[model samples]
Target: MERLSLNQITTDNWNMREAVEGCARASIPWIALWRHKVQQAGLAESKRYVRDAGLRVSSLCRGGMFPAATKSERQARIDDNRRAVEEAAELGTDVLVLVCGPAPDRNIDDARKMVEEGIEQLVPYAVSCGVRLGIEPLHPMYAAERSVINTLSQASDIAERYAANQVGVVVDVFHVWWDPDLYRQIARANGRILGFHVSDWIVPTPDLLMGRGMMGDGVIDIRRIRKAVDSAGYTGPIEVEIFNRSIWDAPGDEVLALMKERYTQHV
Candidate 1:
């Protein structure tokens, strides 16, 4: 319960107030917030709500989607990222997770270039706001529609280009568990790992984006990965971020209880 945190998407239907209250009831120490949830609850009010509930914001989920057809659209995306930085800062969180966007014409190489360049432009603003950026690597299944940053190594390469305090990598078990080089890359990340997300990867996943399983419910060697992250100098919150439809439909308190139980046993 001390280092365990809940990501807001695990309870998709709960509003910011409900989520904060739920965390308080469950004795969860921290929470990772999604942009939409904060926006809907009013950023200032949401911050107050979470703080009042004695919950810390672990990291703000999503600030990047850098690919676009036109230059203006790309700039628009960067502008949105700046806004995300502001929101994270206002919410009193230091880590802002980024999902580097895919290329416009299926050109993975070009998309990769765009993501790097876009982050280079955003880093100054992020630093000025006193927030750290954690670029997240999505699974290859999302290569065509989501992030082009598909591996911890790629994310580490980008994060290495900046000061570790200003930029880092996010390790989400559900996304990078299949990589044979996962442990190696995690060690390479060293102290630059800004966030550690824990979720299971079910074999027969039905949805590409929302099919994540709860910890211990799938085949991932979560404890092994947790050991690696801890050994790599990350003493931060171990966030539980599940997006399964069935989990969301269950009662929020019940889901949180299960999360607590699983964290004790599995994580």
Candidate 2:
């Protein structure tokens, strides 16, 4: 439980201040924030709340959606990611998790190229802000609407293009646990892993985006993956990032208490 960090989305009912205070009350020590909540609370005010609560921000939830039909649209995404980088810096977190978006059209290959180019464009600004872009590949099922990059190997391919400090991969067990090449890719990621997220994959998934289960509630072998990440030399926070509606509907305190229990027993 020492390295546990609650990704705020797990307790979706809590606002920014409440989440920060919740973390403090639970003695969680670290938080992973989402951009919308931060914006709703006012970035400066949110930063102040976390700082005052003596909590550390693990990584900003997201900063990438680089695929668009037009060059202008894509550039707008780049600009928004720049703002995300600034937000991450001000919030005292150095990792900006990137959920590389789906293809704008059917040309997934072109969309992927755009993803790489977008990272290429954003790397300099991220580096300037003392932030690292952590590309989080979504599950292959989300290829149509969520993220085109669908594996740790793909994320690593992109991260290797830039300096390890400027770009890295985020491993979320819910997304990568089924990969046959998971262990090998994790070994290859070594020093370039920026974040690690934990969530079980329900066997009969009810939703593609929000079906994630709390640890030990589903079929994932989370501890094995956690061991692999540790072996890869990433001694960082293990963020519990469940997106299940049922989990979100539960009381925040109950969720936190259970999260701690699961972290001890499962992760």
Predictions in order: lDDT:
0.93, 0.94
Give the per-residue lDDT digits (tens) of candidate 2, residues 173-212.
Answer: 9999989999999999999999999989888988988899
lDDT by residue (1-267, candidate 1, tens digit) is: 799989999999899999999999988999999999998988889999998998999999889999888899999999999999999999989999999988899688988999999999999999999999999999998899898999999999999999999999999999999999999999999999999999898878878888888888889999999999999999999899998889999999999999999988888
Looking at model 1, report the run of 10 residues with the lowest lDDT sum: 201-210
Sequence-dependent TM-score of model 1: 0.98
- Model 2 scores a C-alpha lDDT of 0.94
Candidate 1 overall Cα lDDT vs. reference? 0.93
Where model 2 places Cα greater than 4 Å from the true spot, the runs are none
